[model samples]
Target: MKSRSQDTAIHALGIDFVELSADRVVMSMAVGPSTHQPAGILHGGASVLLAETAASIASEINIAEKNKYAAVGLEINANHLRSKRDGMVTATATPIHIGRRTMVWDIRITDESDQLICISRCTVAIVEKR
Candidate 1:
């Protein structure tokens, strides 16, 4: 996998990659004031960001021509299954479809006890870098 840019949302949100493979990717994020909503629970938008970021990175890893191609998020939808006050949430992304033009990934966000917090499906488009 390539190094993540320092100024991106992933960095800003403190998302850390836990595992990386050809077929799956795992990432973790802290849930606190930074990711909390008005009620002090984990924000749905933050969960979506974690899912999409993991999916996008997984798609980028699958790209053979890194210099000529880039992976970008095409569409994403996430269901907030549960709410958390403060802790760590882990997201696991597995590919549903890996095609030439687009890749679909299923991402599941879990809490510390492995309970589902959010479920997401993300479509990533492989486009020319330029």
Candidate 2:
């Protein structure tokens, strides 16, 4: 479980969760000064962070056993399709594969007007804490 203080990234980015089902998650965030690149568009790292965070949150919610299971990102690859300036972006994530020790997630990012912004794939390794 994470404290509210530890989840400041969501608040700092003004992110909202629209759909958070068992295996799928959809979130939106408004573009802010901190999220912009020097080119005046949304930063590439911000998009990747959004995808990574969404996938991690989905995995975290699936933890139900006595021992705490942590999802550590092992691999992530994302491609930027388009650029937007100062607008709300929505990200949707669903698990492509979930195994006992590894999970692969697919994420799609789109702007408020339904334009593709980025696509990402993330892999996480599950670890049990003693």
Candidate 3:
């Protein structure tokens, strides 16, 4: 399917999708010296970007026919449980709610070993084309 967001595989938000499906979505991005804020660990904004892209893809996949929704990121709450020095990070997004007006999703960012780096909850408003 064609992508709804005005972004490529990797976004200016530093989010990239590795897998996209009807029920689940996988997003990835690098976390090395270039993306760091001088401490050399993954940036918090990177984590949020991952969550946004993953949930956006899920919303795009779950919408009805002739319906298009742009993920406005109504709310995003993230908890940094751990940190990784230098490696790629993946975020798996799962559906929490798929109502007609709004949708919610939870995305967990992890390292290569499946170690939890951050957990996020995202809410997006689903609206018809104006």
Candidate 4:
């Protein structure tokens, strides 16, 4: 599969898709000035964006290839656990539910030391392309 990091918002945020599969997706982003908040830590919104991106992409991949569908995020929530000052943070998204109309994913962001940085969940709506 082609990387989604070429020219999208993911690329703008310096997010790279490391692993993608039917059931799981992994992405990583560098913790630098661009991703930091005023307090000098990884921004919560950046983590949420990474979570949503992973879930949305995984949801799209889980759809039938023959079906013309688009996965759109209906809802998302994130809990910032720990603060990351530098290094890279990785997010892993796994399916919680995969239904015909909606999909739910659980995403976990971890620091380079494997410390939990954020936990998030995203719900995506699967709609047929017109």
Query: Which candidate leads in lDDT?
Result: 1
lDDT by residue for model 1 (1-130), tens: 6565587888889999899997999999999999999999999999999999999999999998989999999999998989999999999999999998899999999999999999999999999998
Q: What is the C-alpha RMSD of each candidate to the true structure, in Å?
A: 1.9, 2.2, 2.8, 2.0
Output the number of the TM-score-best candidate. 1
Query: Model 4: per-residue lDDT, tens digit, 22-109?
Result: 9999999999899999999999999999999999989988988426898999999999999988999999999999998899999999
- Residue 80, model 2: lDDT of 99
Per-residue lDDT tens digits of candidate 2, residues 1-130?
8755255877777777788876998988888688999988899999998888788777666656527678778889999999988879999999998777778899999997899999999988788975
lDDT of each: 0.94, 0.84, 0.79, 0.92
Q: Which of the two candidates, 1 or 2, achieves a greater TM-score against the reference?
A: 1
Ranking by lDDT: 1, 4, 2, 3
What is the Å distance of residue 95 in model 1 from its true position?
0.6
Model 2: per-residue Cα lDDT at residue 79: 99
Query: lDDT value for candidate 1?
Result: 0.94
Pairs that collide in candidate 2 are none
In order of appearance, the predictions have TM-scores of 0.96, 0.88, 0.84, 0.92
Error of 3 at 28 (Å): 0.9
Clashes of 1: 0
C-alpha lDDT of candidate 3 relative to the true structure: 0.79
Itemize residue pairs with steric clashes in candidate 4. none
Between prediction 1 and prediction 3, the one with superior lDDT is 1
* Candidate 3, 1-130: lDDT as tens digits: 7554446535554566678886789988888865676688877877887787788778877877535555456788899898778888899999989876778999999999999999999997776676
